[model samples]
Target: MTAEFWNGTMAAAAAAKQARVQVNAAYPITPQTHTVEYLSRFVNDGELDARLCKVESEHSALSACAGAAAVGARAFTASCSQGLALMSEVMYFTSGMRFPVVMAVANRTLSVPVNIWADHQDTLVNRDAGWIQIYTQTVQEIYDLILLAFRIAEHEDVCLPALVAYDGFILSHASEPVHPLDQAAVDAFLPPPGSADRPLLDPARPLQFGEVLFPDWYPDFELKKHRALADSLGTIRKAFEEFEAASGRRYAPVDAFATDGAEMVIVGLGSMMKTARHTAEKLREDGVRVGTAALRVFRPFPAEDLLEAVGGCRTVLVLDRDIGYGTGGMVYPDVTRILYHEDHRPDVLNFIVGTGGKDITPATIERCVELARGGYRGRVEFWPDARGAEEGVPYTEEPAAP
Candidate 1:
């Protein structure tokens, strides 16, 4: 293993190369462009033996990857925000066809006002796209999860696409030390491309993909896909265990910090969770029983692990970077639902923060803890107010009550 100073985008690119991806078809987009650019450079320098298919648009990019996966080859791509929106149609096609293509998403805010920065809206909105979603907090997690994504996605029992999402500008641009596994180790961990059992588009033995099915049979296919995704949890955990053995780094679906016997806990995704964890430690110094739980695996939902993490707390404060509009934050409802059926449910609160690249500082987390402790009346509130704040307004001030 060699440790080097690398940004999240570079970490993703390095892992894809190590995985020996056969095809990369992606369009250039902000925050995510660096990943595809690095891959192109690798291919050009002969460092990675792969086909770099430059496409006209994000739609074409994912379509190209789907085609490559259809031929039973390992494929990769990177996109964010609008780029991800453009790939929405092909996203379902890739997953429904059971193609184990891997994609790196630099999570960014979607547009109306046109902003480019870190947020989870892009990936969260596409949560039901049938692709396995894994959110990363640090640059190292980006590298590690990308490699693991390929291994889990291609498992014989779970033939599904997977996405590794990291905060767009925060993790994507920030440089950090990452220990990249040696090529020999990576080769041993992941089988060669096309080794997994998948329906190959062979000339001698033809198979149909995206075939029209009557209503009677359609639900069965959907149910099968759902079951496959749910069963993938075992594959994911096994991959995590094997990777830790090989890399000496451990990962879990839900990462908890100082949650034992806590009265309150902060729950979130992406880079903000690191800050929340730090705030929790500081709060502990002040004799506050606060903890943090970061959701690593967003899709197979990890409902069981999440229940174990925050279920014991008296109050669970869910911090969301993406707003679900009428319903509040994207992740808030999910947390509430997970706890609603439990007999020991806590008082769950949702605070939508850091939307459109706004900063989610330690101060923001402190304020959230304060409000939760004070028994704030609203179930859902926006930090810094969704309505434009006056210039120089502090983030700690409570937003208009929900």
Candidate 2:
């Protein structure tokens, strides 16, 4: 059945409806707070057989997920912004220990003024934490990816954590149509959970999952995690295929729009991307020569696919919702890296926009494209937040004060 513009509150409730989740541990935060509220109602209504863990903080929420997952329970949790940052240190432990837990990150901007709004800073900030991160552009992806995340994360080849992310108020609260799936469909797609391969925990084995190890074997352990992540890419592709084969819904590592035979390309992530797309069509009709690429998979970086899309571009603009603090935008660094190793790399531009959920309209994207072709010669340009951004213009972060 199709979802009728259901809010994120009901979407979260849908999770309990679809998955056989055993424990849900979360601390309330804006935008995503309703997710927990709906999930709690599911637990109370007998629709879901789950233990509602009202933790004191986000740290405890994830900690519970790790513990429960280790002992073989379909654990779930959600958090954002400061909450994700607060659990930053322990995020290492959870993934390093290899627990098949899945989380829904309501992507939000980090704060100095402490604002709660949609942005990828929080999720991008934890990019190297060894989790399989996927961003869904639609509400149905949110519901489906959560279920798919469980299957992919728990696979023996990919014993890692996964984050099913979508922008906060943008995707979370915005009403959109989604195809809701039944519990039986989800079960068939996911298969029976054998994460630990037994009932709960068996004292007979008395295994030690987490322990301090010396440096000699640490490198080997770390290497294995690396291999698993790389291997999981194949498994990820497989899972997407399985989802499409069974559900008739498609997904990709990188979702592109009108990229065929274009001289220039624009890259976008999260909700701002939708705006860029609308402007791109107008630019294309005006014969300005442009294409737009959406980054569906951020963690894996989609290097091979990204290189193919922007391979022949004369100019590229990488729009980011958050600055990389000291650097310009995060995508600029990686884009430049992609070009450096290749024989042909385009003139890449970086603009940090929508830092605190500022409005990013089609006009903003149009202006950006215009400035990009202005014959500026530089690798980086720190746009004046969103309000002062200029397209095709060349500028870099000014030198630090002496």
Candidate 3:
């Protein structure tokens, strides 16, 4: 793969700029703002042949995108946190109508106290929507994954909207060497939405897209969406294979590193997986058997790969940046899905870190291994406090800064 350097936000933003979209509409929010901003300039300066729409709000941004793509135009948008929540209704309608409108979400913690930081709560809340969701673990992955997202979402069989995300400040602002990707090569990979392919929006053959569905047909559509979601697992693998062939860099629903012979492992999504990988290597060097996996694609929850990856490990620790309110954390319950279904299960430890862009240092990872080894299975393991334990926090990547 060609190598280069870019911050996560820039990589993602540049991907949007590079991809051949026909129309762009979005309301800016921190972290996700750079994407639409770059596209707006791209359109203004004649770099891209597309309409750059200025919208009043997140809802209008998505509404415009849906309207454009419905008219046979390739469309996209980006936002996060409160902005995503604000467009939550339109988000559902966009997907239900089966428009291939792909969005980039800067995953962030929802505000009550008005904090601007990274978390998965905003995207996770829309998990029920009929959208194909994909998560990333690095800036490089973020750059590449968006390319895949468009091709997958626009496929005739899929026709589902896609949401690609990276943690807000963690990955969005975090710098990493990444390829900008060859635009000519990308065009070759994904040709413009050809006529025979899909979305017969020809005025000569006018069609009604989303008619009202009652109980009988609603269930069928819902079943179709469910099957399509399941179908995406295979589609993603096929897409990755194609991407690997084209880019020469392989990816998977679950990307594993050095798991063999390890007695324990850690699982996490977004950029925190990078910290977990470094922590694993350090633990291995210290004679503590360990390995790590970036739980890259959360939606079709890579059940097979995850089960196989951690099956041999006696202990597995999962880190969730978003808490499921009274349920401690989300990943634990999802992990329990496999742990319960499997004949063999690892002793899974749940750890929450980097909730609000708290630096997830290696020391905290080591401590987590120690705590799990010590047989501590507290539902919520708060991060260490120098003077006293903090109530709201589930765990810190390090001792709280004094």
Candidate 4:
């Protein structure tokens, strides 16, 4: 193990090299640019024995990775926001082909207004694209999960592409001390090249490629894919457990803090949940019963673990960084679905905050808890006094001048 001060981008690049990825197809984009930049340097320095393909666009980046994976090579790529949008079409094809390609997404807000900051909107748009999605809240988790992603995606029971996403700029640029595992340890955890549990395109064994399926057979093919996705939950758990045992860093699909005997629970994803946890601790000091729930694995959804975490609470407050357009925040609907059939589920409130990398401080978290106490009747609630946001001031409190 090696502990060093590293940002998310460096951590991701380092993790990829340690995981022994054979090919990295990349195109520079905000926040995610440093990830590939670091990888390129690693390859140049002869530290990583891999092929780095500098592509023209994000679409071509993922397409190149898919091509490499087709030839039984361990492949990786990184993107954010518009980059993710461009790669969307290829993303579905990669999953449908059952290629175990791993991608790192620096989650950012989508365009039209032309904002490039931290938000979940980009990845949420492709939620049903048949790829496993994992969100990391800290720099350490970013490094650890990217390493684990290869193992989980290449598992025989789940040969699907996976994306490890973290808040753009927030987690991506913020530096922290991470104890990265040595290459030997990672090699032990993952399979070598051409030995992954996925179908390959070797010339020796000529096989039919992804042919157009007739209507009669298409549904069954999709059904089987869906079943594989559902069964991946067990594989995810097993990988996390093994990683924890080897590294002594515990992780879970749904991570809960002080939820046992709490009256109110705040549920969210990414680094904002760390802020919520701090707020929960202060609220507890004030004799308030509060807890925090952070969803790590977004794709598998971890409905059972989520229900177990918040089932005893009197109220569940969902804080989302992305919206679902016509309905409400993306995560809110999922939470409601988990408790939909329960006769005595807690009242759930949804608040969309921190879009486009708006600051979500401890004060903001406190405000959310207070609002939830007063009761909310709306489907989705924005930050209180959101008119200021329309005027370019998203945060209620201004930072003190130096």
Candidate whose lDDT is highest: 1
lDDT of 1 by residue, 32-124 (tens): 999999999999999999999999999998999889988888999999999999999999998998898899999999998899998899999
Span of ten consecutive residues with least summed lDDT in model 1:
393-402
Top candidate (TM-score)? 1
- Compared with the true structure, the alpha-carbon lDDT of candidate 2 equals 0.78
Q: Give the range where candidate 2 is weakest over 10 consecutive residues by summed lDDT.
A: 393-402
Better of 1 and 2 by TM-score: 1
Screening candidate 1 with a backbone cut-off below 3 angstroms (N, C-alpha, C), the clashing residue pairs are none
Query: CA lDDT of each candidate?
Result: 0.90, 0.78, 0.79, 0.88
Shift of residue 212 alpha carbon in model 3, Å: 1.9
Per residue, candidate 4 scores C-alpha lDDT tens digits across 215-291 of 99999999998988878999999999999887888999998999999999999989999999999999999999999
Q: Between candidates 3 and 4, which one is better according to TM-score?
A: 4
TM-scores for all candidates: the values are 0.96, 0.93, 0.92, 0.95
Model 3 ranges off by over 4 Å: 1-4, 194-196, 377-402
Please identify model 2 stretches exceeding 4 Å from their true place: 194-201, 384-402
TM-score, cand. 3 = 0.92
lDDT (C-alpha) at residue 334 in model 2? 73
Residue 255's lDDT within candidate 1 is 92
- Alpha-carbon lDDT of model 1: 0.90
Clashes of each: 0, 7, 4, 0
Residue 21 displacement (Å), model 1: 0.6
The stretch of ten residues in a row with the least summed lDDT in candidate 4 is 393-402
lDDT of 2 at 70: 72
